[model samples]
Target: MVTIALDPTPYHSTHSLLEFPDVAARAGYDALQLTPHPDFGPFFRYPKADDALVRNLKKRAADAGVRIPAILPVQRLAWPDETRRRAAVRNFRRIIELAVQLEVPVINTEFSGRPDELQEDSEAAFYTTMEELLPIIEREGIRVNIDPHPDDFVEDGLDAWRVIRALNSDSIGFVYVASHTFHYGDRATSLIPELGARLGAVYAADTFDHNRSHGLRYITNPPGNAVRVHQHLRIGDGDVDWGELFGTLAASGYFERDDALVVSNVFGEDETADETSRFQLDRIRQLVDEARSAD
Candidate 1:
């Protein structure tokens, strides 16, 4: 079955790391994707989780009837700078250890490279870092899904997938985030099919097509400044074609996969997160059902 998980970022401020499973359960989720958190894996830094903390977190999730299918740790793995790239590799090894300890199979992350400066170098650095970490990942039997985040060196979805494919490791896959549809070249129909089983997970959120209205959805200062603008709006609040996206997933047999994961990561409306999360769960289920029926 497609595991619907909550990102739980909205509750980070109010809830402790150990309390996340209960929050996810209260929000109508049976699983939660652990993102970069200070208590566990902070962004671009060494992880803070000890063996005791990991054990307690696992127990908490079990008690709350929640499973953590994935963990997202944003590291500068593709940084053009050697020092940062080395640090990222070091941090990622520990992250893989944490994943092994927690029994989580997937680690979703970004390319984390500087595209604006020395794009080629960033790509090269990414490959170098992967050379160092892929062995550990494969040995541990963990899957790493890369998201071509906006502003990353490989923002285009296909280009990112090519980078992952060139690595030639099934341990690496792609994360299709709905909020980043435009940045991904708005090619879900083709991209999802192209990735096929390599599509590790899908992040559920809505975003406006910045390319619309002559790229005026958001205005930046200094006119031609380098910026990537997007949002993590609730479903139906943005321009993402829910019908087309879900339809493509269904037709591609994603719904039949046992490892399929869809995460609700609406970070815009924390004030109403509980209600929004519940709504997302119901709406996502509806979309999945509708897509399957149509398929």
Candidate 2:
């Protein structure tokens, strides 16, 4: 019943997002969750001219009744060195600037574990990165939501909390992926309650497959594989626990009408994409309506 923002990358890649943003608006979502892609050529790319185009595009979205609340930058943070780390931080600042202009509140990032950073004092490195990055987040008046994915250094809800606790920064938080928790931990259901407040956004996906995870790319450019832990699909098609999941979101004070759901289960049958996504959205709309009417 919390609000829904559809992650459009699953439905459309980098080049295809401009075209699909309107589709997302028409699909009854108020906001869009942007993804980062790496190899999206030099020009004519989606996020390439995003800075210059954001205002007008936001206006367009306004006309379409969709507002962008967050953009997920998952890849660059996973880079193996300080150089890439700093550059990614700068890029994240840019994303926050766009969010400010678009009136979005958060930019989702990864608590990346790159091969090198992990070998060293990961906890210290993570906080150090945040210490340097916090100024940008605060300057932009935005929170950077960093979640622990299985592929990343910080896995499971508890470790995610440990890192968040270690950093102890107001600007940095966690993105809860139920599938990630389920696949990578002892008891995902147990972790959800403890992680509720830390949960910045709910990344609802079906499977717990860590191999082809889809939400990891921070560039939003094309060609680079999105290190997705799960291939997002319609509600009933995957292994998520809907009853408890919905209950958790409903109870979480952070849940907002502006929250998003990035649909990516458009892989199977062409008909499946349309039919399944539509049905899922409809059901979600009903849930939202029911929640509102209850109030």
**Which numbered prediction scores highest in TM-score against the true structure?**
1
lDDT of 2 by residue, 249-277 (tens): 55544445344333332333344444555
lDDT of 1 at 217: 85
Residue 279 of model 1, lDDT score:
97
Q: What is the C-alpha lDDT profile of model 1 across 106-136, one tens digit per residue?
A: 9999999997878999999999999899999
Local distance difference test scores for all models: 0.95, 0.58
Candidate with maximal lDDT:
1
